[model samples]
Target: MDIRWIFDGKFFVLDGIDGFSARTSTRLASDEEIKIDAYLKQVHSAHVFVIDDPEVMPRGEIEGDGLITDIPAIAIGVRTADCYPIFLMDIKGRTAAILHAGWRGSYKGIVKRALEILFEQFGISPGDTVAAFGPGICGNCYEVGEELMEFFPPEFFRRRNGKLFLDLFEFNRKILEENGIEWIVPPPACTYEDDRLYSYRRRKDKSRLISTVEILPS
Candidate 1:
């Protein structure tokens, strides 16, 4: 529970708990398991989760990147090492969502889809939103292949030294902005370059990914 609380008067984020969730990763200690029968997570997949069933949740499926729920007592989570973790809230911060944006998730436009779903499903528009970009690989350390650079939708990667670095912050920002979400808070820290967060690129062998959570105000 090494959490960092970052909020802007209204929205708050609980960051830095990596749950090697929905995978058989060996980096997680046995004791670190959170047997949350009621909590739901996307497990880094691109699918979205909505808590429609009150029948206690099962071990979440391995597909989903964004989770939004207005249901009480149901918590959502997203895991990331070098990938981006985003928390978005609407309803004046009464309802919230946890987002996962790894390179794959980003390529799938999962965050954008999540925004659309929010508008369609919850009647929330990006104009009524505020976002927090938690710890992740910044543009400096997220070097990737030309193949990856081309995979993104032109606004993803920035070139430097004839090499490309993935700017998850910028890419996601563009997506949010296009969808009407204009307010965003970005950190000056890079997960791969900082010791505060685990980075897959920094220590490929094993690193602690950062997980962020937001509890909607009651």
Candidate 2:
């Protein structure tokens, strides 16, 4: 009943939140500009943002895909509906990431960018990255045609029953694994299949699901 933390313990999901909160007010009710200052950025769903200083809550108006930070206290949040919400943490406990892996973002290789950013910008290695993928639309419920398959190579997308199913979880998991990351924990729930969850695919409507990842004890 208490679904506070997702992926077992990959990151902290503030107590009030359990998976996706439907009326988050981020889009329809509240826009980012009217809501949080500029420090929090949006990604159009493609690049990666890095948060380093935990103390600097600047009001940035940058848009990108993923977020990586070595700042222990600063909590990075990524919003998603049926898209994957992944958290990557290094063993040193100095760096962590909040990644938004949607259909478009996945096609653009946002996860790959995050790993590259860590290595080039922060000197972090892909081998040290441990992944924790939270709930999203499962393959069974995520019904897409061949068009979705073009977003990824043969390895990322697979053929299922003459239809193409996008396994963002498995795709990203393989990504991390191929890059040398072995520690990964995945959630068993599917947003589209579970009525309790908010799924854009299942509902077939326009709504947003809020899956937030934040560091605790600020």
Candidate 3:
């Protein structure tokens, strides 16, 4: 597990790992090294869940693209191969979440929905949160069809010799900024461009990178 810890504490991003797809809960259940429980992630369909909801807390795996929690020591994770993984945290509110924001999910407003939940459920304001857009396919490598291109903002698309590429980072950043979240950490790597990271477009396999966020117990 080539994991990199970021975000000033327990948040982690699994990097350079080939062919490892341990389900979020499965890893947490088997983990003896870390003292935190994990929330299983179900991604890519544009769903969102509040971990405190009576409806969400008992599930072994959440059927959503996003998960948020104020629960201490319970880590929320999102898995991605070519899609973006967004980590959101409100330090003073002691709340955090991770979202799987692929083109489809982004078009469906996953980040906006997650922000709404944080503000409504945890009394967190957008300015109070800091976020990180983790490694994924970069615009230079992410060519898309017109159908997909039609949903994005003009600035998020690049045309090269009539081929269109989608800038996933800029697309999500626009959404975050529109929602009043200005403190976002940009992606450090591109999955398609960097062989050290796994990418669906590059690998055509089940291999994925897991990004997680955990608030320490008080």
On TM-score, the candidate that comes out on top is 3
lDDT of each: 0.62, 0.60, 0.70
Q: What's the TM for model 3?
A: 0.79
Residue pairs with backbone atoms closer than 3 Å in model 3 (clashes): none
lDDT of 2 by residue, 1-218 (tens): 23233332222232332222112212223334222211336555667766665555544467775776665445466666688877776654556676778777777787878877777777777666566676688766667777776566666555667877777788778778877777676754677875555677766646654444444323
Q: Which stretches of candidate 2 lie over 4 Å from their true place?
A: 1-44, 54-60, 155-162, 204-207, 215-218
Give RMSD (Å) of candidate 2 vs. truth. 6.2
| TM-score against native, each model | 0.76, 0.73, 0.79
lDDT of 2: 0.60
lDDT of 3 at 79: 68
**Can you rank all candidates by lDDT, best first?**
3, 1, 2
Q: Per-residue alpha-carbon lDDT of model 3 for 96-198, expressed as tens digits?
A: 8888889989888888888888888778988877777787788899989989756887889999998989998888888889989977777767778866567
Arrange candidates by TM-score, highest first: which order?
Answer: 3, 1, 2
Q: What is the lDDT for 117 in model 2?
A: 76
The superposed Cα distance between candidate 3 and the true structure at residue 144, in angstroms, equals 0.7
lDDT of 1 at 65: 70
